[model samples]
Target: MKPVDDDVLLTEVQFKELFRDQSAIERYMSGPHPLVLGHRVIRDNRFLVKISPDNLTAFKKEYPHDPIVDLLTTPYWFRVHVYYDIVTSEDFVVLTHGKPGISDLPVVRIHSESLFNRFPLRTVGNRTSSRSR
Candidate 1:
């Protein structure tokens, strides 16, 4: 597997601090929107989901009897990470709610970190951080 980026990792303290903002909490509570990430499936075996009209049409053509297609096309809530460069007070207010009609893509916030990005520390223990892990 490819190495995780250090900048993407967040310390436990930083994670807690970020989550403490009321707006951030509100945003998380409001979300779970259907957004796609690069992660593997943990539950359902369904690998790909057809969302757009073209993809949906093709999916139906391939599997006419599959019921999952209907579910995929419908809106659903999905939780996603929202990365930020500098953790500011305003971020809490901006990211607080789910935008209607917005595509359910989860947001992964890539922030600055030393261990992940610094080339000198290449070992997994030295470089791996929790947020990206």
Candidate 2:
């Protein structure tokens, strides 16, 4: 999702030991941008590290064909689905699509995910559904 953080790197053991919810921790670890570095133990999980504008050579070399700078700079967006979390009985996000939307203000669709077995809470509005997913 973003550039990896070099500072505050943690090992698998340290990560497992540090987090209480093993399942949630596992998701974080296995996700595309796992916070752990050496097997992904970085502290900053969300925001991407700023890529050096001048020295993109090495960065490009490290990830040939995968243009990090372009991907980061280009207009990229994701289509998110707003659904209710069955376990929590509250709203949750499920990423349905990725890439910029055709319309600037795309209409939000409220649908009950098949996995949720008939959950409620559906609404449609111009509001950004809290930018779900």
Best lDDT goes to which candidate?
A: 2
Mark the 10 consecutive residues where model 2 has the least summed lDDT. 41-50
Q: Relative to the unseen true structure, what is the Cα RMSD of model 1?
A: 18.2
Write candidate 2's Cα lDDT for 1-133 as tens digits: 2323332323234344445455744543454444332233233331222333444454556656643325334442456667675566566675532332454232233565444324344543433333342
Per-model tally of clashing residue pairs: 11, 6
The lDDT values for all models are 0.37, 0.41
Candidate 2 Cα deviation (angstroms), residue 81? 0.6
Residue 54 in candidate 1, Cα distance off native in Å: 3.3
TM-score of 2: 0.24
- In candidate 1, which residue ranges exceed 4 Å CA deviation? 1-39, 42-55, 58-65, 78-88, 93-133
In model 2, state the lDDT of residue 106: 26
lDDT of 1: 0.37
In model 2, what is the error at residue 68, expressed in angstroms?
Answer: 7.5
TM-score quality measure for candidate 1: 0.21
